[model samples]
Target: MSHYAARNAQGHHRVHKNDPEAIAHLKREHHKFRKLVDRINAAKTPGAKRDIAVELHKLLASHIALEEELFYPAVKSRGLADEVKEGLVEHDIQRFLSAQIEAMDIADPLYGTRLGVLGEMLVHHIDEEDDEMFQEAKKLKLDLDAMNERLETREHQLKAQYARTGRIRTPALDREVRARNAV
Candidate 1:
């Protein structure tokens, strides 16, 4: 079974009641990110790895949109400006690596190396985000349930967009890109 399908069959463990709902939601995505990395490692053939890579890219793109569009901005507004900036930079690195990975065939000599590097980076990024930024956000006293609700809606919209076009982008990220390019 697919990692996600297997997880669904098992059902989610209960999250702590005191945990921020938004953070809980994001933690789940982070878990999936790690699972996809495992899938890459376990894939015995290039074709299988290629399919997993594409799925990971779609999910990562949408997940990044969630953070860039809503989560980080909300945290930054609460005075964690430096943390938010750092998170955005990490995301940019991930995006750059993902683009390169997509352009390469799994049969390429460097394909596994590059994918492994990206996987390592993702694991590091996820750890920092979860251990540092998320912990801080929980203490920032944002409206957790409301944030989770919006994140849920955004996820649905992004999934729908990907279903229609096989890609995802957000106006929030578009504006950010434009601003950076204008400089």
Candidate 2:
């Protein structure tokens, strides 16, 4: 059975299948990204802005990794076909932007413009995920408590692994998410 399907089985009967706690955590991270963007824009020192941008890049990367692994698959399993496809594509776009931001020098004159564009992309992407993907998850009639527990479990696993390695286990999850949808 899928991990999410297992989660659905782990709790009492309910109307939702994923963890609200996980969602709340993700929301906080999204806000952090917004604040990072603000910091990158507001800083007067090039060195400070550059440092902030580097940290922002890492945060965005990890956040995207979590969603791609845990959140999107759950929503897709609940039958959000178009949203799932578009969301993956959106992830690719964001990854591209993240890479660009990572490579560019913050002291360059064009840094703000580049960061602004990336911030705009992120804002739009977050809106779609929260509005469409997350809303679709809420519409699912599974046992929410069970799902949340499973999410917490899965997130714990991911976090533990990240703590050990200081990076995501990307190949494994990439194969898992894509293969799950591909099938």
Candidate 3:
């Protein structure tokens, strides 16, 4: 039996270890992101590349919001503060790069270069979260099934909101915009 199987056999596996819905959802998102990255890299025409980039941006923005709003808080509450903090910083970096890519003309040579760099950064971030952070989270006694339900609901709401507004409403960004409008 595997280590996880053995742990479960011993009745020591956490709720997340047994039923990892939130983690599963995050992994599915990562897989989709990876496929989109590959498509972006293989795009032949500038228009195709631009279209894929927009799709990627929307997908990643929603994914980041899901993590920041739900997954990160759950993990952080379980004593994974460092990983959550690093993940937030990485998200900021990705947002900056994504905005830069969006501003550049698709025909520009640097556009592809920036897209490639963003793909690499995304891959690295995904690997770290999947390999290290998720493992750590599984060890904790978190109610992952509840977290999963919350994430799923929020993800659906965000997608619908995006469909209407064409942008992800991140909490931080919403707060910032609200504060600015109040001035």
Best by lDDT: 1
Give the clash count for model 1: 0
What digit string (tens of lDDT, one per residue) describes model 3 on residues 2-70? 211222222212223354888878876776677777777778877787898898899888898888778
Cα-based TM-score, every candidate: 0.86, 0.71, 0.82
Candidates in order: C-alpha RMSD to true structure: 4.2, 9.5, 7.3
Per-candidate total of colliding backbone pairs? 0, 2, 0
lDDT of 3 at 12: 19
The candidate 3 region of ten consecutive residues with least summed lDDT is 1-10
Candidate 2: tens digits of C-alpha lDDT, residues 1-183: 121222222222111334365565565566666667667767777677777877777677677777776676777777987898887877777776777766778677877777767877776676666556665676786454455566567666667876797654678756755664563
What is the C-alpha lDDT profile of model 1 across 1-183, one tens digit per residue?
244324322323223457688888887787788789888878888778878999889988989988888899899999889988888888888888898999997789888888878887887787778778887888886897799999999999999999998778777687886676465
TM-score of 3: 0.82
Q: Model 2, stretches more than 4 Å misplaced?
A: 1-19, 143-166, 173-183
RMSD of 2: 9.5
